[model samples]
Target: MLLQLISHSLGWLSAQVSAKAQDALIAVLSSGPVPQHVAFILDGNRRYARSKNMQIKEGHTDGFYTLRKMLEVCIHMNVRCVTAYTFSIENFKRSPAEVDALMDLAEEKLLELCQKGDILDKYGIKLVVVGHRDMLPERVKAAAEKAEEMTKNNDRAIFNLCMPYTSRDEIATAVQSTIHERLDEDADDTVTADDIEAHLMTSLSGSPPLDILVRTSGVKRLSDYLLWQCSEDTQLQFSSTYWPEFGMWDFVPIILDYQRKVWSKA
Candidate 1:
């Protein structure tokens, strides 16, 4: 019911009458102290594929296109950093064929983002892969490395793709890095939480932690997402639509609603 209202309201917004492409939405987005870093839990690809009786790879393909669209929107909206959950550490525990297909998709998408990625390049998006890279296949690593290098000069936004990442693994890696940093510097036992955060490879070291986190598939749980960054004032919005079907419309209203809560809505 609520989504219907939002959909109807936005449906009437055509390009001719559209004021600044999302003037109202952008007004709301700008009103608030905007989210510097936002993360996404992209889920329900397999389920969506099954509902359509299509191959899982087909569903992943759709999801990939959705990601491309949203990244473009994020660039336009000026979201500083956006992270998408691509794969988990335990995903390897799935059936061999399914796991292999997922790996192939990841590898393919990595290559796409690297060599022929005009959209990302056009928007000055820097690609950063977050997760246990050591666990990834050599080919995937090469693709990710290539993307990072290809987009290194671009700085309009940070696109962090999480592959083989899990909250438990992130914590363990943080601990290991903290220990290594202190020992490497020959520092005594006076290391604090701030020191550990500084050693973190991603933007968790920023002054303001994650401001908004979006999880699709109507899933309420964070489920091992952003263990260190989501502190107080963190906003969470869930979309029942699968990640493949999610678009800026899904995100725009939610941010507008949130903006109303944090600041005056336009």
Candidate 2:
């Protein structure tokens, strides 16, 4: 019992020290340019679970907490908009049991965000679930809607959860919407790139232009996430750390590298 208590104490002390160090680093980074909008392709939860000899669900849970911690740092650093690739449309091909587990987890997290005094409420962050809502389980979809409604009035920051989404689908949907609008208005003008962009999920959700996109687990590909928004100016960062193990230290260097690029361009 004493050994366990001592171990817990040491862990707590280490976490406190790490957090203080991170805060100091953030303070210094804040004085320079910070990315106004950031996107994350959180990858490798299953691999992380395997590495830790844990269940896949447990790895996903840890990934969720890592996302929360990362968001706290982004918010503290005054990042105006953040987007996460929470689930991909391709993920539906996984085993039924795994998909069901993920749905349950999504519902639980969405409902938690809807609760008063939660992170979204406390930070005045608007929660936008961007994707094919009809594809979600009824309960999960409802929870997502509730979370969005609960935080609709917040303007301080935007948190976009792209669940069961694909860039091709988003773009196709935007194109269809743009065409339909033009048809409804009986306009002779041809559809423009700007018109489609105006109907995009990100733009409709009022998310700022993406400045940086980071994919953890050393993945270098975009994997059909935010394809249209990743212009030449967007910095793409790939980290070797898995999503569940990613921390503030893993993120700080990406920010610094982005700053360096921005400086060089100037």
| Off by more than 4 A, model 1 | 1-33, 204-208, 264-266
TM-scores of the candidates in the order shown: 0.85, 0.96
Q: lDDT by residue for model 1 over 135-237, one digit each (tens)?
A: 8989888888898889878877888888889877777777788888778989886767777666555644232367788888888998887777675667888
Q: Candidate 1 versus the native: TM-score?
A: 0.85
lDDT of each: 0.79, 0.93
What is the TM-score (0 to 1) of candidate 2?
Answer: 0.96
Residue 87 deviation, candidate 1, in Å? 0.3
lDDT measured at residue 153 in model 2 versus the true structure, 0 to 100:
98
Clash-forming residue pairs, model 2:
none
Question: In terms of TM-score, which candidate is strongest?
Answer: 2
By summed lDDT, which 10 consecutive residues of candidate 1 come out lowest? 199-208
